[model samples]
Target: MSESKKILVPLLIALIIVSAFVSGCVDESSTSQSIQPQEEAVTEAETVTETTTEDVTEKETITVTDSLGRVVEVPKNPESVICSGAGGTRYLTYLQAQDKIVALDSTEDKVSVGKAYAIANSYFEGYPTFGQSGSENLEVIVSLDPQPEVIFTMYTTNGYDPDELQDKTGIPVIALKEGDMVQNREDMYQILRIMGEVMGKEDRAEEVISFMDATIADLNERTEDVSDAQKITCYAGGVGSAGSYDLMSTDSYYPPLYFINAKNVAYDPAAPKVAKVSKESILIWAPEVIFIELRPSQFEGENYAPYQLENDVSLNQLSAVQNEKVYGMLPYKFYSHNPDTALVDSYYTGTILYPDEFEDIVLEDKAAEIYGFLVCEGDVEKGMSVYETMLTISSTPVFTSLEFD
Candidate 1:
């Protein structure tokens, strides 16, 4: 009786195990089907995240607004570029963008812009030479070796439209004007960034822009306290129709003016862009300080007074003349109009106007700083020696202009 009972128990246990195995197999299939959609969703989410990360790494595009306020899209990295103005050359050099230049105009011919020309000669050796204003020999521009991808023009009163120029040359003409350059430094940085994009030198452009930002900040900190009371009115530009009394027109480049917070006697805020005063008018204003930008002829002219003092009673009566404040701002390099030049000119003028404010800076060191800043290899010390010698030879009442003419 006991053996039969054991066999029945074992048979019942085996039947129950077979039934559980069949149910578990069905459950496993249903669970896998449910998990497949979840897995698919996870895969889709991963794909979307990867796409978004890629977009984030892409570079930003730039849009430049021309003088007319038209927004134009430019290349993210232009391999070839052309600058049509002397001012533009300074910006390119400051941006370390000489490599991007495919062509440059002949604006460097004038002594006023010779430093830029010298830079081009030193750094941009075999590039094409586009003519200036009338010099942009249309034929030469059309024949550039590799052909330019873009052409840019600096701010100017009159110039050919870049778009039209591009249409004729099959290159995009991008205008980078400087009318708003002095108001905010952001404008300068933006232009440099845009140029970097066009020239494929964004990194160098940013570095240069940063350097300018820091330099300007340091300069402002040093010169912020300079007041109008301490400033000396500076007269720039070549003496106009008048001899020794002529001054630059109000609209001309007014360097060292706002830097020292000085009153510019020649400055007529209301003067039309073309308004120019005669020598008699300049004498009427008689600025406390006078600076002369002499041309070769003017520098050598018999009538020029940098060489003679006392006997020129006409000059002796002048306020600046009576005080020995008249200084012939010898052309340092080019016209002294770059960012460094502008600041240096302000420092030099500030010294002349208020010697106490810059007592620490001697004139010789100041001249050397300017030359070094401009990357001029010319011996600034020797140059200053020449200037000093010239001034001594010309400053006496007996010193008469030796006219070769």
Candidate 2:
């Protein structure tokens, strides 16, 4: 073969190998470009899945029916809560679920003296104040660091709609019907039951109900046989509007009166639940026994009902004052009816009215038992101390006897 022919054949083979190598490189580059978009798409899909899962986790909720018959979606396990109206905090404290309370109404925080709950749960004093009772501050509530999951309030208040409140605060608002505790006890029970369900303290709620039931039954059994002639005509003074004090104010259906079967001079079918009667009417009624409901304001002032009764010229003529049948009782209706304190008042009223029926009872011991069961943390002695403190601060006679001449 010629030299030129040999060189041309080798060059052609080299050129063919180069062409194949370049084609392989081009194919690899195209493949890398195609795989990159697919990898990015997979990463984006994963990110979306994570975000959706987080949203679902954050939005978990459950349905509840409030006392006003409004259905609402609330947190499954509410970690933070606020009691927004009068006596609203009382319910939470009664349930022993005040640990979950993140904020309080201004009235609850502002009042230095009142109900055993406030005295017992000192921690509540430090909680942030959302607003005054019946008038919550929407901006302050929304600005809470760990936002409250729910808001509890009374159904009877005007201009406070649960739906509107929930919408404004982005929190569930539950309105409970807190009727007259003496006249409508079942309503109170229902309120407790609903609170128990919402607060995850159903068992504790049942325990309280049982205590109240047993106490009422025991009280009734002792006094059931007493004749109408034996029943003492009584009047509860200083039964002012919630959270205030007025000497002439009285309850038409005081629990102590109902429990002990006493005749309430203020009880009139036509009268409002709480009524203000004149001194002339009081003279006409001439109650045999008078119970002065000690108020917090009276603690610092000289206008306490007992002192007023003692000094009043017209009141001195009444049999209760003249015969010294006047007694002092812890304010049963401060903020609202304190069922526990009212129960304690019942025992005192019963013992005074029918000494023979309650001869075995001791007032301080009995008060301790009720307070321990209802308020104290299983410490009967502490309960007694709290009760004594209440009496002392209010300037009330702890255990005055009606048999005194």
Q: Among these predicted structures, which one has the highest TM-score?
A: 2
Against the reference, the lDDT scores of all candidates come to 0.55, 0.79
* Residue-level lDDT tens digits of model 2 in 1-405: 999999999999999999999999999999999999999999999999999987785746777787888887788668888887777777777788888888888877655454788877878878888886557789999999788888888775566677888889888898888876666788888778878888888888898889899898898899888888868788888775753355578888778877777778888866777877787888898998888776554343445566567667887778887788887777788777788888898998888888899999998899888887677866898788777776764544555632222
Error of 1 at 191 (Å): 3.1
Deviation in angstroms for 150 in model 1?
A: 1.5
List clashing residue pairs in candidate 2. none
State the lDDT of candidate 1 residue by residue for 1-405, as single tens digits: 699998999899999999999999999999999999999999999999999988886444457665446566666666567778655666666555556677767655443322422432454554457888524667777788666656777655565666666667776666765532245456556767766666666787776666555644544555678665755565543432322322333333354554455566766555542235565666677777666533344344444444333344554566776666565543322332355545555666666666665678675566454444333323566434432332332222111212210
Candidate 1 lDDT for residue 309: 30
The alpha-carbon lDDT assigned to residue 343 of candidate 1 equals: 52
Tell me the lDDT of model 1 at 134.
28
